[model samples]
Target chain A: MEESLYREIEEIIEKYREEETPLLCVLQEVQEKFHYLPRNVLGYIAKKMNVPSSTVYGVATFYSFFETNPVGEYVIRVCKSTPCHVQGAFNVLQALKRELGLKEGETSKDGKFTLEVTSCLGVCGVAPAMMINDVTYGNLNDERVREILALYRR
Target chain B: MAKTLKEMEKAKEKANLVTIYLDGKEAKVPEGITILEACRMEGFHVPTLCYMEGLSSWGGCRICVVEVEGQPNLVASCVTPVREGMKIRLSSRAVREARKTNLELLLSNHPLDCQLCDRNGSCELQELAYEFGVREIRFGGERKTYAVDMSSPSVKRDANRCILCGRCVRTCREVQSVCAIDFANRGFDTFISPSLGLPLGESVCINCGQCILACPTGALSEVSHVEMVWDAIEDPGKFVVLQTAPAVRVSIGEPFGLPAGTVTTGKMVAAFRRLGFDRVFDTNFTADLTIIEEGHEFIGRVKKGGKLPLITSCSPGWIKFMEHFYPELMENVSTCKSPQQMFGAIAKTYYAQKMGIDPKDMVVVSIMPCTAKKFECQRDEMCASGYQDVDFSLTTREAARMLKEKGIRLEEMPEENFDDPLGISTGAAAVFGATGGVMEAALRSVYEISTGKTLEKLDFYQVRGLDGVKEASLEINGMEVNVAVAHGLGNARRLLDQVKAGNSKYHFIEIMACPGGCIGGGGQPIPTNLEIRMKRIAAIYEVDKNLPLRKSHENPAIKKLYEEFLGEPNGEKAHHLLHTHYMPRERI
Candidate 1:
């Protein structure tokens, strides 16, 4: 929305100015900067890249890692895979949901944490694994989920 | 010498002959051709849903699958190329069952309201369902219930009936070079939408209606103004008049079982008169006026050091496209209003004045081979006559539909001449239906007017044909006038890109947004393919040759109009009513 913000996006696109498939790289960098892709940001990216906005929107919405909505400072992804479910992942999710006072896909009241479900973290060796932002929290229980969330609340 | 397609096909077949088996019979065919083409070549029938001619094929719909020996599953024939020693069966029991199942699946998601649907008779999906003998849809589930989008003035978007064939996506992107839509989201929730999921009206859509022509079902169609026209005709207090575009004459006969390129202009006027139109005029009359007006404008720019490369602005689609994409080149487009709008302006103002009628009481309707004309008529700047110039702008297809509703068969109607004053036109106006027609028409007048000589050859053969982009140099008054003609917005983009890069050398240009000009317009009759376009083009040229007056300046009525109402070409009086300006638009 700011002049500087548009200048910053132009810089990010300029990094891949010569790359053939620069759209994915530019979007990845943009998502890292804003924590999520804003609609206006995606539109700006499309204008800078000379690509259609539909393609940009498609790619942004396809990957689960890229969120189109505004997430809190910390995003909690609870694994809902078969291995995690067998290891009481539901109870771990319920503990986090109760602790944060938020349901799935809802951010906390204080903008501290957001909760959502993902397929798997590919760290299935630990069975019941959840991810907070980029860090994986494996072998989680109800008590451990509360204790882990308390640290972010501080 | 260039090789014809037939000669090239023969050479390809001879050079790379491959052994293949078709339904237990051995056959030799060309390699690298698609299995669908191979089957069609061998006279083995195969049904397809997503495969349209002149578009790229991806095996999205499995309805064209065939049984290939040694393969574990049936392969989609539309995307699979023929290989050496391949055995394929088109009508095997397994193949038929798969095709039938796929058809039922498409029907299961689609609403079964064919009787009340807009595309009831002309829908390809309906034809396929009938041909396959689909008794019922067994897989019943939650159908896609997306709301119909009536945001645009010209084309309507009904995603509820979409088959996800992606034909509209391909046509918008590949043919027109307007990437207004693409696949959004993914998998089951995938939808074709404009950039950033905006409504079609707010999006950078020129309303060319190519997507409606590309759609195989009821997913897309022209925003119908037929009811409005009908309501006006039924009102006893209102007087309704009609004008048909030149391109409509060649294609309006198609819906009534006439041939693709039959010139039925006289019968069209007769049908209009029978359908309750008080006066039936030709848009060709204003088309000749455009040649006179735009020709003088070109000469003015060339003489007075105005913007070189004056692009013709007769196509409303091309005008909007120039506004949104190439706004920096706004000065290059001529300020002349399109013939359809020009006819409307003069009809409601000049004609009403001459006939002692009120402009507010008279309704001017235009039947065009363009969907963009609908949007063009409703633009903010079109009401120069203190009222809406054109009351309704209907497509050629819509005009034929109205005739069918009134039981006025075009082929059965007797040939009749158009009314005097505004109905008279010349041969130069007839060529406006085809690509490069405006340039050809302009060159005829520009050459004669500049040199003060009668033209020997009326036809500019170099500017005529089905080529995407054409360039020619005409010597007028000993000055080499470099000119270019581009049809289809994609070709327009290439030529405009040259101008953007400061590499353009031409002094004048003609750009029409639809392929093959207005004959292949977005609002023309259905099944407008390359072959049909060439047929319509040849027929329009024939209409031009058969007419006695071949030049625009020689029209007696036009001279009379100038002497009585308008003083001269490009004069102040004519500028107030016939010329319009453009604005820069934001690309979504």
Candidate 2:
């Protein structure tokens, strides 16, 4: 709850105050600004919008895109869909986990990388795909995953 | 929305009629009515699990599916609107098979521990299973078992028994406007949980227990204090005393096979005495005490400009709601403790000392028509008697169960009177069980005290009814005293929001957390719909009409207690024993 963070949340709420069904947009902007939705910020938005905190929390937890907890600077989400699994996505995921020394849904000790398994990332053409901080790395094997991890190490 | 039978009848007069076929019988019904309403009007009982009268239609269970002519699949009757000449087969073979299959699917994941469940006999799912002749499970699978949440003092949550009807969610969000619980996850992992998956005790739950009344299963129930009460009564060193609330006497007869709104005050007293309570008192005694203290505070505020529009603090649920949602208005709320807490405070101190009994050895138990009373009695501020004032609080339902467990039949018991001093009350106190009763009772006393004259007409009809909000104005000694009454937390929120916006123009306001007040409390009998609530309210007025003393200020015992012990209303000693303060709470 830094002063700057509070000011940013207040600005976001003011921007969407008059829009119909503004909860989703307000939450999306909040997540984008803070990297994850903080508890106090969510409570502040609920009070400003005159909506129940439980309703806001419900919408937040219902969708997978919204995160309530903090994540690493670079979040790596490995696709675990049918097409990706057929293309040996497990090996790619294992390689990433070993290289980063992080388990699934865990952030690294240095807060540099977060490893996660997600449903289809909508890039099935490039099977065994993974995304890190908006950059997609697809057609991956152990060597490619290791190379991908090394690129972000510095 | 699913309209009740009464609402449907009212709509039939104004709306155009549509002819529909039910089991090949032509029936004319309201144009915009649902198939379930048509079935009910035609005397065809279509079974349903998720469909309630006044709540929004959620068509989740699919148990009320009916075959419509020319439709490929059976449509849920609860959600489908009737059309001209639409043929509906309510209990046909296909419909019955679909319902049974739906029940089997629901049971596939539900634990079959009905015999040991708290709602075994009265469970809607259990009743439906019996009606559908579902003796054996056709499909077996891995059952979902969740750890029960017993964190809250008022309500318990067992997600394993929930049918995902969403009734409790709707009741909390739509009716009470306290959206503390909702569907958290997606698909099979979905379960009702508080905000951020916090335990209910730590959430913004007001503990009104309206959700329990809406739940068709035992997934949500009152946390019982029966074991503790039983232990207190059986202890040789304890002098266990009981106090029954005004609302409990009118509604307790429902669990004993009696119709709703039956006044069994005498029988309730007899049953408690037979169950080994040393004395059976009335919370109405302290309800009378509340009026004396609160009415005086109101007059003082008006005269001294202490605070205008003094709000009542009789309902703990309403108090908690005010704390979380309207914290700024907490200063306007009355400082008097609720009648139940006041009785506990007085019983453990005044009564214990007068009767030559040690306060430690005296256990004060209260029988209330509320779930919030369970939480209210345990509050840190309620221990005014140097100990926990009220040791345990039980609901009317729990009291009935205890009576039955002791083999005491309420109908067969001889009529008896309550113990002296703490048992006697006025007709105004008797009406405290219903919505608007507090305002009416206070008006009766306030008007007389201000004018120094008796009131010829006792009933204040303007403030009495099932309306969500009620307003009335009275001129007392050339000064207009405007007042408003609101029941149900949703209605209270509306009124409070108006007050917060500086739009309120009243001198007093009475707010009850439950719809129709304590008679329709969360701990009342099951099936406590609008119809039953009205009946219970009528019975409350009937009790009031028959009583000799109708004003709280005129109660002989209360007057005696004030004259003998407490010198004056809202005095130093009375404030220490009866009044309390409030604090703001986090919205999350």
Candidate 3:
């Protein structure tokens, strides 16, 4: 049986019960456990924490780290900064797109990959880099990107 | 911090004095006061957009920025506390440039449809723009545009006009504790919306309209009923009648050049007549009726072992708040329809039958100092007369706009009287505009009715101030009737929580959603602050003081209403026409 969202939220709330302003930490843990934060889940969290639903929503949406929409098993972020753009990051992005058959901000039909364009991932030394499920791959080319995609696909 | 004026005054006496140099001149101010307050105290003007006096300062809008001699950057004077020997330039060249640039930047994204906006002359952003001489936007690029949300009957949200000062957000959180709206998205794409970006009507919004009042721009305003009212007036088949709330009479003069809280009931009636209403009545008439009916309900409840704490049900906003936040106490809330609704029901049923007119053709328009009254009037249960009891609930502001469009000046109109029967009311009815008024009005009649004695002094001074919550215990016929009055939803929550905890001692509670009752209502006036609320409260008391009839049950019209039309105060006919029910709602 699947674990109930309410029970999960309760455990998260209990973990931070002693902390003041535990909403952000609770929300972070909830998002970590689940790929995305559900609207009803947010409402339930708000009720449990005695915080206004709007305030919770504001905090959740303020930082881009928390995803409100459901994501696939792995989210691929292609860095599109000055250093990466100066390198062959654009071609690397196109190669990854072609390899995955997905557009930016689109999830694969198999629910295994979500492609996204993001700012620098703090790896300017290894330009033309991208991240996949918290794993960073720097100094990428079209061949390297396709190879990385194959590794994730399998 | 939004400290009360009384508290601020008391603090000033004991506050350590600090000397500050203003434009190279030495001035002394209370140490704990903010620079903005200190500046104003010294009779210097510091323009602000996001800073509201009775709300916590966000300091997000840099319009109130002033120069400190040592500080590298201009500080937001509203948030910066006054310090000793600090040099400040209120209107230096650099300060002016910064302010003007900020105003222009705000204008760059905002829609320039000032004349078409409901808050054209009253918009703080527009006022600042004009004052700063911002001729054109210097950085006009990438404007945020979104569809207007007319989802709520009480308020309209136009994202196109929002400057993101967060006054509405702060006011919703601080004043009402509703927190129904907040900034949902990040930079440029950010806009005020309910949780999960739901429309306001779908949220837990109580339709209080405090957000609309706190809004410094056209971003939030009442969903207008002016056009529908005009159409009703023009229709030959429709017999449109007008009813003005007690608060409307006191504050309607502010829109014109008259002073705040000027009694314009006569002139307002005259203007309604000019605007083509068949008859101009007073909600005060039903206010008197409400007291009678509510008093009877309270008496019967206390006597018959029904629900204790029979809360007065005059404020629609408070009703919605009860539905959302305190549904378990639904039985405690008085089932009596508000004066506005009661007037409509009577006008359509008894008055219509008496005048030999079809109820269908009778359009009841109410001029209320409430935006939630719009939602109340349109409730499916409001159609006790086989048609919607009230056709439209126009805000005082909206009614003033209509009068302006019709070229009817309230200041010039003669001191006429509201039409007969339904127009006549007692002094107790007039004070329904102020906080603690309904309780006082109810107490006056409750004491008199229960005791069967002519009370020498009618004034219930115990519950007649602008405190957030007021309590009084009265021995009516040896029955100790404990009562509490709470204005503003935040204050209402405090008492409701006590009831929810099963620790409430009061037998009756009067709750008004707005701060100063209807006088400081969301629909009252643009600048309905602490000063204006007090003035309106004083004016309402003045109206009560001078009236020949000081109590609700003493009104000749109300007595006649029961004698001729309604069988009794809470009789079968009266109950059917004058009562309604509430349902529990999903908070989010």
Candidate 4:
């Protein structure tokens, strides 16, 4: 399995070898091929490219675009920015706490949902918002939050 | 109004102070202060990566996470304000775990090239990663790749190591008011970039480097001349002459395990010698030359009606700022190159002529308390003698690192003097490193020259210390020399704007890029913030007060140099070797 994954990564690298934005393309390809970018695979890519692992790591870490850790089956992110806070995101957060029986920034015991608080979601017009996986839910209320969480539950 | 605890105390009944246990020590703190602030007030040194003084708190790093009684998750003390009857544990297992996890997350993205990193030993991120005992990053992924932006003369930006603390963004907008950089994108794609994707040098960056100081990692660092300097030092064929700027003596001590403001002049001289430099000179000597040239230039401008409000051209940061933000004000800046560059030009020509050494073989290295000096040395017109005047420039921190790498113990070394004529400087020149110092020093020299009478009090108390903007006037030779001093590009802009609006006019102006001048230069040392800058500024004044010759003209070595080599101040010989012209920057 490891050899196959390595070969796949190498093939992806070859496809993006002459691309102007090789790193970006390679990152996307790896993410698609292996659900999450693995540490060994990144190391292998870095070595194959003859680039410093740190430079590669720094690039991976600098942009919020890449995720090092794997998310649960469903990832839930709450907007705790100033505008959202002013619109009572704390109450929505409490509602999430009660519904999931889990605190902020924790994954549910059943591994159905993982919760987090992000900076601004740039949906200030809607005020409080949450993103389940990649889908964003805006103007969240207690009832709406429960209804949303219920859909993600196993 | 911000409604701080101290401010609220005067308006109403004093809010009861709460006692909190920090690392087993009990201390009373104001009720509304954060646990970090409370612990810091109590003198508990909790290592934090993302915390900064006088900025909106953003607990993005989670390095300052602390255990609070009744809280389920570890809280960022920086953002979490203190509450009455709140029990806090700073270094608890859970707190450590959270901090460790956060650091590991940060490290998973961090590049591991510490040796090549400019911030190497002094980086907060590197220090924390070491402290957290993160042997390996359990989770790693695709790294971000961006071209190195070396377009800026002063600062180099590496987005890879950036933790997105927004300190640089906040500092640029709030402190400096030069909104050159901002968060360009959202979510995972988010990164700080100049507006409209302009290169930093082309943007209205002002070259202050406050953002570099604000950045917690090697993501932002001064463009270094270490490799260039090391190469020169290694080549026995080259006569490497090193010059240390005045501000360096006070601030360089911090990196050497000495307290901030500890003046290590003798040790600095010793370190240069130990670094295998052929000669160790003082920028203060040329700083004295600057006064002679700049003072006469100011008087010449005033007498001839050339340009009123003749600004000091010593700060390269300010020079760059003028070129970018206030291109119209370029004519107001003095034609003289900075003291460090002046010394470099002279060392290659005048010093080489005196020593009977070939100018080609002479390698001039300037040790300054400035990152801007790095950009200054690489200027096209700086090479007056058919060779680059300064082969390389080292910051006070870099010099300290070189000393450490060479295994030289500065404190244990015997007191040494700077080599011959070039090394000499007066007290007035020494004070040029502090805020308002150049204004004060130039005033002392200009006042004496103009009036033909010695001033009783050498210190210009009005222009001294760490205020952002300082204004003063003195009647010299029956003419009111209206003067203003500004440190940090933010303050520089405010003062220059007033001048542009025709609100005020002055005979002389002093501006340093970093707050508190060279003593607080971006390249001085890690933790080069306001408090440390103030301490170094105080010590600079103290050094000035203690010296016998408080005026530039009183320096015997300078007088001798003029007598033996150069005929007079700003003379034909001096102009050829000491003075330099400025170039108008093409719009970025």
| Best candidate (score: TM-score) | 3
lDDT of 3 at A79: 87
lDDT of 2 by residue, A1-154 (tens): 7888888888998999889989999999999888988777888888888888888888887776677889899989998889999999999988988888889889988889988877788999999999998899899999898887888986
- Model 2 lDDT tens row, B1-588: 678787888999899999999999999999988999999988999999998877899799999999999999999999999999999888889999999999999988888899878787789999999999999988897776789999999999999999899999998888888999988766676889887678999999999999899988889999999999999999999999899999998898888888988899999999999999999999999999999999999999998998768899999999999998889999889999999999999998889989999999999999998999999999999999999999999998889899999999998878899999899999999989999999999999999998998888989999899889999988888899999999998888878887888888989999999999999999888878899999999999999999999999999999988888888999998999999999899889
lDDT of 4 by residue, A27-125 (tens): 777876665555556557766775433334445544443444564667677888899999999998889888878786577777677776777778889
DockQ of every candidate structure: 0.61, 0.62, 0.76, 0.02
User: What interface Cα RMSD is found for model 4?
Assistant: 11.9
lDDT of 3 at B324: 83
- Which of 3 and 4 is ahead in lDDT? 3
**Model 4 docking category:** incorrect
TM-score of candidate 4 against the unseen true structure: 0.74
What is candidate 4's lDDT per residue for B1-588, written digit by digit as tens?
A: 123333334433465787777776776776776777777666676778767875677787788998888889888888887776678888888888888888877777667788988778778888887888888878695677777788887788999878788888777766665666777555565677764355676665766677888998888877767778888999989999999998998888787688988888888788879989989998999999888888888888888998879999998878877876677787888888889888988888778989999999999898888887887888888888889898788877778878887898887777799998898888999999998888889999998998899898887889987678898999987787799999877778888997787676677889888778888787778888767877898889877878778899888987877888789887788787777666565332
User: Rank order by DockQ, top first?
Assistant: 3, 2, 1, 4
Model 1, C-alpha of B307: deviation from truth (Å): 1.6
Better candidate number, 1 or 4, judged by TM-score: 1
Off by over 4 Å in 3: A1-3, A78-104, A117-130, A137-147, B4-6
Candidate 2: docking tier: medium
Q: Which pairs of residues have clashing backbones in candidate 1?
A: none
Better of 3 and 4 by DockQ: 3
Show how many residue pairs clash in every candidate, following the order shown: 0, 0, 0, 8
| Model 4 lDDT, full chain set | 0.79
After TM-score superposition, the amount by which residue B352's alpha carbon in candidate 4 deviates from its true location, in angstroms, is: 2.4
